[model samples]
Target: MSSISRPSAAASAHAETIRFEAADGHPLEGTLTTGPGHGPLALISAATAVKRGFYQKFAESLVTEHGFRAALTYDYRGTGGSVSQDFNPRHISMADWGMKDFPAALARLELVAPGHRVVGVGQSYGGQALGLGNVSERFERYLMVATISGYWRNLGGGFKLYALMNLVANPVAFLVGHVPSGMGLGSGLPGGVFSDWTRWCNRPDYFFSEEPRFDAKNLFASVRTPILAIGATDDPWGTPAAREAIMRHFTNAPVETRWLDPQEAGGPIGHLDFFRSRFRETLWPEAIGWLKGEAQA
Candidate 1:
């Protein structure tokens, strides 16, 4: 493996733009947040449709607070920095994000910090996708935030029915050949990614229940890394039931599940808010401490 060059110190502390390639040879874009040498390496994976920059502050904190050797945040194919001006969206799928994009990031991390044990800190779909990827064995541990099954029925109130109708986004994607930034829809998702996502959320078992299902069940079951799965009490996408539904797939991983209550910390910690900069004083430190094994679960 070719060594990944570190940027100048000024550029390394914040966002150091980097490029890598997937197994399929698709170019991917990311940023590295560097720390002092000889610390653990980390990869901060973003949620679906969320760009790498969304986790900029969080990635930086891994160095400032947790003393990571370096932290990475990358965009999936056809999104954000990874998408070239001439990129084609017609052929992408959710499986590509898991089985391909994530593994690419893991490979990049290995080259960036050759001997360090890697920690995967993923948010929402980011954490879910990790299990489907083939690189889980490379991770020393996982920090799963707001990551849960979107099976819909596990959610409370009318949200389940609303999620069942998420399939409506698929028709729009088919018509436009890409998902438009419509109400309740993520922008720039490939037609197949959007369709596959809706298909998972609408099913009784999400991705695991699909016919001719992707190999996620087997992949996840094989993971032996320790996992800390955090679900927000107020998060519609990752309720207690939703978290339980998806985490069961990791049959061999020893997972410690925790519910983060925004009420206890004085904020509305929804599905996406847990990683926001505002919580740097609250959930952020708590999570970092957890990953460092500073405290018991």
Candidate 2:
């Protein structure tokens, strides 16, 4: 048999790159997509395992179809092409993300699209980051898709066991110089991000049990941004009760929650599929309709 050969392509076109100094002074990398008209600036944030390019299709829709002035997406520290391994990997915390990289991204966006209203669209872990970022009045609107504010109680038997393993793996990570496994919905985040996730997962209030710490409650209460929360009826991490719990945290802000059935949204769509689904053609139009204050029911 003949050997297989890799496909060849033309030279790559250059995309604009910008670097921001995070609140903690870490350099963060981002990509900017300028739109054809002056409209609200959209800032897209990705989940832990997802890179900035993960939002490419969505960003295109926001600019070309929705008329958003600009869309900016970035990788968190230690993920994607941003500064990697600059911080301690063994003991990273979500608080560090909220305090550092997220704020830097916001500052950079403000500079790039000065005097424009900003909207945040985040998915999964990225949605959680948006929730944390909402404590400030920086964004004009928020859209959280498949977000987890804390943890889900009923993530099935496999997730339950994975949660148990994370507790043991976190401390071991520090000793072995390995990242904690099972920190993400899938696998393999940076050691620092993984450790932070492990700490949050083991907490009773978020995942393993319901006895959440008082600080966790305060963290939820502090967020005052208006929001549109979206979830799938079949999502394992976003079960009805779990979604409601997340909504309860945003009582201080005006919130609209949408629980979509797969068939209704076009076809069978789960958590990740919501973004990668035809639902955008159908579901997003409705969501955007609601966001534009057009559909009220």
- lDDT per residue (tens digit) for residues 35-118 in model 2: 565667777877656778767666666666676777778887766666456665555555556556777788777875687778
Off by over 4 Å in 1: 1-14, 85-87, 156-167, 210-213
Per-model TM values vs. the true structure: 0.90, 0.81
TM-score, prediction 1? 0.90
- lDDT by residue (132-239, candidate 1, tens digit) is 887788888899998888777776535645543464666777788777665465456777787787778777788885546566778789888899998888886677
* Clash total of candidate 1: 0
**Residue 198 Cα positional deviation in candidate 1, in Å, after optimal superposition:** 0.9
Question: Which parts of model 2 have CA positions greater than 4 angstroms off?
Answer: 1-15, 149-152, 157-172, 175-187, 207-216, 292-297
| Alpha-carbon RMSD to native, per candidate | 3.0, 6.7
Name the candidate that leads on TM-score.
1
lDDT of 1: 0.79
